[model samples]
Structures are given as structure tokens and as C-alpha cells.
Target: MNKRGKVVRDTNAGTGLISIDGQQFPFELEGMWKSDVAPCVNMVVEVDFGADGRVASVQVVPESQLAREQAEAAMRATKDKGAALGKEMVARFGAGTLAGMAALVCGWFVFNTITVQIAAGYSSGLSFWKVLGVLNSPLGFMNALGGAGGGSGAYGLFAVLALCGPLLPFFVRNPLAHLANLLPLLFIAAVCAIGYFGLMDGLKQAQGAALAFGGRQAAAMAAEMASGMMKEALRAVSFGLGAYLSVLASLYFAGRGAIKYLSSRA
Candidate 1:
């Protein structure tokens, strides 16, 4: 029989003891040693036993080979565990989560929700993720913080919350996941609110300047012109197909969560 274990005593040129499954066996270097890897104390080896129950031959296990085997074993265990966990999540959450995830991913990849028009005559569209990127940038960050650093940080905060929507579904059993999915709608509303207020502020400023310098006639004309321009701007920035899909995904999650929560309560 061949057994694998480590050497408890070094036998570089003479006899020493090795442990194989709690049994120590005596080995000699003259004939028993059979590998290029030097037999040192604590080195793992395969021990071939003789009919007399003594160590017949000992071959050292290479460190590289041992490490490779250990790594492969760990990888296999992780793969199996991950597969089991995925199956469990699928079973627990059913297709609701999968569908929601698919829709949410599609929404993230589709048409942008915000449009930026430059005086240079070109315009750009931005999705929620891109908006988050802009918010995180130095220039955008400074602009978001405003002149006195007193601007509402709620936009970035809500955006961060909205980004977490997809991750919440992984909880499998948490009812709070419904709230996470709904964050997208809130974020969308927030963006729209910001745009609306910005347009209104611009309208107010134009009217105020016209009234102060150009009299009632100018103020009335400015108000009329600004109102039309505001409507055009709103059309330019109206919610894209992506926003609609994201809303649908949020609604799905909400409906699923409500049913699940009620069922659990009953």
C-alpha cells in the first residue's frame, strides 16, 4: 500500500521518522529515498509500504504540484457552491427577479433620459449611469455643489440609491428590495424636477431683467418667449424609452414584492 504524509524528522544522510496517517514509520536514505526533491522535515511524500510493514520507498511530492492541486480543488469547491447558491436564489425568487434584472439591464443600455444642447448647435444624450459619471467628475461635481458649495447633494445621493436598485434583488428574501427598485422612478422625478426648476428660474430671471430695463411690454414679451422656449427644452429632455423600461422594471419588482410580502404575512 502507498500512503501520503509528511516527514517528522529530517533524514538527509541517515534514518528518520515519517508520519503517515498518525503512524510514524522509520525510513533510511540509502535505498528508500527515490526522488530528486530532497527529503526534509515537514516535506510531504508518498510512502510505499513493504510486505514487512516498513517504509519501502519514499517519493517527495513537489511543492509546485501540491499547490496546483490545492488551487484546483478550491476552484472546484467554489464553482459548485456558486452553482448551488444561484439555483437556490432562482428557486426562491422565481423568474420575477430574472425578468426584472433583464429589463433593468436593457433600460441601462437603451436611449438616454437627459439631453444637453450646446450653443455650438450640437446636442448630447445621457443615460442615468452617464449622469452619475458626470456628477462624479471634478467639473460636474463643482457645478453640482454650486457657488457656495450649498447646492443640494440630494441629486447625487438619489442617483447612488438608484444605481443600487439592481443589486438589491440579490437579497432573495428582503422585502426592502422593492424600495430599491422604486428608487429609479424617484431619481427620474428628481432629474425632471431639477430641469423644471432650472427652466422656471431662467424664466424668472429673464422676466425680472426685462421688467427692470425694458418696461412692462418687454417683460410680457420675455415671459411669452421664455414660456415657449421652456416647453421646447422640456420636449428635448423628455423621458426616453429607457426611462419607461426602468419604470416598468420598478413596477414589476414592486408588484412581486407586495405579493410576496402579503403571502408571507398571511
Candidate 2:
């Protein structure tokens, strides 16, 4: 005989009880179904009786109550896993590690941006080496506070923006989790800007200068300028690529650490 009922474990006796309607029947839960359906309290279950009248098997009836119980169990398991991972991270890396790493990454990103911009500026003939030296220094970051009036001023502002990009995410804890997703696109934009403005523009200017000179001297000077521009463009490309890759790598690692920290905190 098979009857639908709710499972009730007798804690003192360490046995199973089935409550059906107003009556209670004692039964021995059998099969792997016993453990599988163990935690679903008050859930409707099918109790099968053997010919000898002992309980043969127990199975949970699929219903809204059972679904809700399963969902709750899954949520609990997920929370437990998250807590365990958080504890492990704290034990291994400590609590403040993520914040420290983020600061280091931000500093590196700012430094890399400054260096790349300086190299590109030199290639474009927009600034001399001495100016590039000052701009590449730590004090150059102060330029970010200044206004954008001239070309170099605009470049300085760009440098400041680049410095802020990785660091700003750290200030807004919620968005730091998504920095990895944004780094690839940011790297691509940096490469394209470096290629067009730093390399292609310089080549165009050299072509224009060649056109203005006239005769064999003009041809020789234009060739020399074009060659120089090409060399500088290659150098700028290398610097841009290096800076972007380094920043992207830093962001990737820092983003992961931030995610772990946030998940554990939550």
C-alpha cells in the first residue's frame, strides 16, 4: 500500500514517522530516497508498505512546498560556499590585501599613462624632451589640476583622466567589481588614439613639410623627416602597447580581488 503523508523523525528514538491526515504511522525509511528526502520537513511524501506491513520506501511528492524547500536548500548551500571562500581568502591574503593591491595598481596605471603620453607627445613634435621629462615626473600629475588652454594643456588633462580611470573605480566599491570587463575596451581605445594621433598625424605633417620645401633638397629633407617620424611612431606604438597591457593585467587581478572581498562582505 502507498499512502501520501508528511515525514516526522523521532529525535529521541531515532526513527521515522509519517503523519497523514489526523493519524500518525511509524515507518522505517528505506533506500537512498531516505537521505534525499530527509530535510524536507512537512513536505508531502509517498510511503510504500511491503507485504509484511513494514515501510519499504519513502519518496517526496513533487509540489510547491517541495520546490520551495529545495530552492531554500540551494540558497543555503551557495551562501555556505561563499562564506567558506571568503574565510579562506582572509586567512591567506588577509583583509587589507585587496585595498593595498588596488592602490599599487592605481599608482602603476598612472605612471604608465604618463610615460606613454610623454613618448607619444615627443613623437608628434608637440613637446620637447625637457617638457616630456617634467611631464613624466611625479609633479606632472599636478597638471591634472590645471586648465586645458593649449595643446599641451589638453594632453595634460588627458593624462589626468587616464590616471583617474583605474583609481576612481576603487573609490566606488560597487563598480570595482566590473573593472575587468571594461579594461579590454579601454586598452583598444588607447591603442587606436596612439596610432592615429601619435603616428599617422606625425607622418602627415612630415609629408606637408616635404611639399613646402621644393626641388631635390625638399625631397631629401622630406625623406629624412618621414624616416624620423616612422621611427618615433614605432617607439610610441611600443610604449602605448606596453602601458595598456600592464594596466589591463593589473586591473584584471585587482578586479578579481575586489570581487572576492565584496562577496565575502556581502
Q: Write the residue-wise lDDT of candidate 2 on 180-266 in tens digits.
A: 434433533554465456556656666677777785688678878788867774555334333444455556645665675577567
After superposing candidate 2, which stretches have Cα over 4 Å from the reference? Answer: 1-192, 215-221, 232-245, 248-266
- Give lDDT: candidate 1, residue 30: 77
Best by lDDT: 1
Candidates in order, TM-scores: namely 0.60, 0.31
> lDDT values of the candidates?
0.71, 0.54
Against the true structure, candidate 1 reaches a TM-score of 0.60
Question: Which candidate number maximizes TM-score?
Answer: 1
| Cα misplacement distance, residue 18 of candidate 1 (Å) | 2.7
